[model samples]
Every structure is written in structure tokens, then in C-alpha cells.
Target: MTLPFYLRGLLLLTLIGCGWLLWQDTSDDLDSAPTAVVARPTEPAAPPSPVAATASVVDLFPAQTWTPAPPPTPVDTSPPKPPPLPFTVSAQWRFENQSKIVVLHGNGNQYTLCNRCSIPGRIVPGKMLDAHYRLDKLTDTTVVLTYMPLKHASTLRLDTH
Candidate 1:
């Protein structure tokens, strides 16, 4: 009489698989079939020119050799400069007698300087271990001192503001 429900389902699945395989086989055969080619008219080839036949091969852009640049020159790195002058022109003023005075402060001591003169009591205001200083020039806002033995000049500016 009749197959069970599970057997019927299995038979239906087998039939579907066989049909799919047959379809794939026919598609492969269609793809492998020869295709027809249509002929087209072709132009006759021209003979090569005599100049081109005699021309030698030449490279328009030649290969270049790479070369590394020379090492950079050594910088002239001089030693660190010495510290600045310790003395500063603290105050400057002119007396009624036309005498210019410059007050210098250094090392916890105040030394009063006059134009073309050393500090009172002959104490050098800008004295250092390596250099001695003498009052060189005086201006309204600047005091210039000459380094002794070296003759190097240094200026001290007063902060008026």
C-alpha cells in the first residue's frame, strides 16, 4: 500500500538532489560548447621605414648611481661663557656741583662710584678673582667699567622704571 511519512520525505529529497545534479551537468555542457566567430576586415601592414631599421637602441632615461652625502661638518661649539658681571648700577644721580655719582651693590655691600674714580676707600666694586675693575664711564642710566689688566669694558644698566 503506502510508504511511511519519513520514507516519503527521504524519497522526495533524493529526487530533488538528482534533478539539481542533472541541471548542473547540462549547464556545464552548454558552457563547453563552441562559440561562433564573426570575421572582420583587416588593413594591410605597411613596410618598416629605412631610418627605423638603421637606428640603434638608446635609453632616454639612464639609470643613476646613488651616492650618500658626506657627513656634516663639526660645529664650532666653544666652551660655556663665564658668568655675567655681579655688580649692578643701583642708582645714579648728579649733584648740584656737576659731580656724577653711581652707586654699585655687590656681595652684600654698597660701593659709591664717581666718574673716572674708584669706589670710596679704594674698594673695587666689580672685583673678581681673575679680573679687576675700574670706573670707566658713567651715564644717566648706565655705568661702564673697564676690566683691569685686560682692558675689556663692561656696562651696568640701572633699572629706572
Candidate 2:
């Protein structure tokens, strides 16, 4: 059976490619044949001249003077402060029973916060609610939140809307 035209052409090309590669490898091996190494006599180093002998020690080898490093920069020893509060009071309500509630709209969510309570969700991971933040106080027009980790307090005024 006769092979298809495309198959015959492919076989011919493969054979030619393999032969070319073999030829290239053999040619490279012949060209890289090792040659003999020839050694030349080495002369002794010349002695230093009078001018070089009279040169200053600093010229031959630089003098390394002791330089006192700049005094260690002062480090801040104060305790770290908490980051700014991300919440803002959007609305607030107070009942006759003295209970207060506020709607805090921040970070794209509304938090219904009551007096002396922790905010829902975490401001930081791996921390208790009280350690992360506390609703320290709630007034008719303002809310006080204390970030216990750094003892930082932030006040948000309630808006009528």
C-alpha cells in the first residue's frame, strides 16, 4: 500500500533533520580535538625601586582611622496607641427606661449598639471583644468607645438622620 502524500513528506523531513543534527555533532567533536599545552619559563619578581621604598605607609596601605559611629538613634519608649475608630454614629435613640441604642454606620455595615456593650464583629483578630473595643458610654447625642488594647477612646456624635 502506498503512503499518503503528507505522511511521506513528513517522514522525509524527519530523516533529513536527524541526519543534519548527527552531522553537526560529529563536526563539533572533530573541531574540538585537544591540543598540546606549551609551558614558558617564569622570571623572578623584580625588587622594589627607591621611590617605592620612600613612599608613605599610608600610600602603600591606607591607614584605617577609628571613627566613632553616630550615637545610637533614640528609640521611642512610649506605649503604642490604637488605630482610629472606623465607626460613625448614623442615628441614636433613648427610651424612658434609660436604655440607649445607637446605629453605627461604618465600613459599609450598620451596627446596632447598646449602652455598655461590645460592638458586633471584630475590629482586629485574635482579641476579645472588650480588648478590641467597648461601648464605654452612650449619651443622647454622643457615643464613647474605648479601644482597650491601647486605652484609646473615640467619640462619635449621633446624627438625627
Candidate 3:
């Protein structure tokens, strides 16, 4: 005969919810509503959803088909680096024995380098630590070299001795 308040509200809500499907967070709703024995459809049941509308308002407009464009790909923009040198270069407490020289020992030659000066590239191993970057500064465990053209700097970390 007549629906209970919650059942009538549920039916009214079901009618309203179909129109607002895109804006509703209906994730918490129960899959099926509790049915009463006399609760039968007066007319044919409303189409289940906007997406599945057979003769509902959704059918009044052209079929809505949307395909999102693919995202753009990324490009890498970096210069290739040279291999690392393996020579032993030291600027420890002996940097200023008498003439502020840092010792480079390898490649059958020993270079006595001073701060703010560069090597000649002949004796540097693998040439990773290029002669272009001057021996700018030195400490017990590291050497700082400045690349003149770009003012870019590089480091040579020495193994503990």
C-alpha cells in the first residue's frame, strides 16, 4: 500500500542519484537495498545508471564517447662525462715543503702541481680529472679543480693514508 519513510527516501534518492553520478562519492553505499514484500515496480524500473541508460535522459543527447590524449614523453638533456683518473694525487701537510707543491704520482711521471694551476693532460689517468680544471684548492682528503671556460669545478677525493 504505502512505503516506509526510509524506503520512500531511498527511492527518491535513487532517482536523484542517477542524475548526479559523476559528482557523488557513492563508494559507501550498500550494493543492494533491503526490499519489502509489497514493494513492486509501478512502471518498468528506471534504467540502472546514466552510463547504462536505455530510454532515459542520457538517450536524449548524442552518445558521449571521450578518449583522453596520451601524455607527452620526456627528453634527457645532459652532457656525457669522461672516465675517472686513477693516479695518486696528494696535497696533504707536505703541500708546502718549500714551494707549495702537490704531488701527482702515476703514468711514469711525477707532477709537482701548485694551487691555481693545471696539469698538462699527458700523465693524468683516463683523463677523467682533466688538466683543464686548474688545481684551485687542496686539503688533506680532497682536491678542488676549477674548469676555466665555464668556471665549473670538480673534486678529486683521495683515499685515507
Candidate 4:
């Protein structure tokens, strides 16, 4: 025969409940509990040191003193003795194609000609032959004396003190 429907239902339900409880219990048991830990002690130390000295020192006295310098003065150039030769005599007559003349007779009797002789006026010394025909006399320096004329063949040199 068969259980009445209601009862069957109840039974099924109870079984299911019990199965679930059992599964729960097993799962709980599998989870582990925590463990506790204890302590330990440690160690120490070290030391080292010292180094010194780097040196410098200097001093010695002596600073400058000394003197000497002086000498220079002497000068007289020598060339101012040439003004006296303004003519103690001077003469130059040249012609060989005619033209080269200088006639100066100084010492205050003054005569001059340097325009190449054809002497006609302005060459004193009694107008010297109206200017040239003979005035030969060269070099007599107490400061200049010179002359020339040998038919006008020019070139004469004389140096009588």
C-alpha cells in the first residue's frame, strides 16, 4: 500500500534537511585554527679612531735700498767759422760756348758778376774793364780769394793760406 501523500512529502523534506546539516558540519571541520608564535634576542658593537697634522710657516726680513746715477754735458758743434769768406776775392769767367761767370771782390771794394760775363754795369771795382778783359787772380783765402782769365780758357785752382 502507499503512504498518504502528505506524509510522504514530510519525509522527503526531513531527509533533505538532515543531509544539508551533515554537509555543513563537515565543511566546518575542514577549516583550520590559527597557531601562536614566540620570541628571540640579538647582539652588539664596534669602534675605531684618530689622525692629525699638516704644517706651514715662513718669515725672513730684507726689502730694497740702493742708489747712483748722474753724468752728461759737453757740446760745441764747430761750423760757425764760415762767414768770414764773404770774399777776400772771387772770380770765375767761363766761355767756350760762352756763359759761366762769377766775379766778386769783397773787402769793401765790392764787385760782383755772375750772369756769364758781358759785364757792362753793376760789378764794381772801378767797373773792372767795363766788365771783363782780365782779372785773373785765384785763391787767397783769409776767407776766399779766387780769379780766372787766360784768354778765357777756364779752370784754375789755387789755395794760398
Evaluated at residue 70, the lDDT of candidate 3 is: 77
In the range 18-87, model 1's lDDT, one tens digit per residue, is: 9999999999999999899997759777888887876765778987778977899999898544346778
Q: Pairs clashing in candidate 3? A: none
Please tell me which predicted candidate would have the highest TM-score against the true structure: 2
Clashing pairs in 1: none
Error of 1 at 105 (Å): 0.5
Q: What is the lDDT of residue 135 in candidate 4?
A: 40
Local distance difference test scores for all models: 0.69, 0.70, 0.57, 0.46
Prediction RMSDs, each to the true structure: 19.1, 24.9, 22.5, 35.9
Where does candidate 3 stray beyond 4 Å? 1-66, 76-100, 105-110, 115-131, 158-161
TM-scores of all models?
0.37, 0.42, 0.32, 0.21
Model 1 ranges off by over 4 Å: 1-82, 116-131, 148-151, 159-161
Which scores higher on lDDT, 1 or 2?
2
- Please tell me which predicted candidate would have the highest lDDT against the true structure: 2
Summarize candidate 2's per-residue lDDT along 48-74 as a digit string, tens digits.
887777774456676786997789999
Give me the displacement of residue 20 in model 4, in angstroms: 0.7
For residues 10-87, write the lDDT of model 3, one tens digit per residue.
Answer: 999998888688445454354455556776678997767855565554535766569876798877777555444445
TM-score of candidate 3 on Cα atoms, chains taken together: 0.32
> Which residue runs of candidate 2 sit more than 4 Å off their true CA positions?
1-63, 66-68, 94-100, 116-131, 159-161
RMSD of 3: 22.5
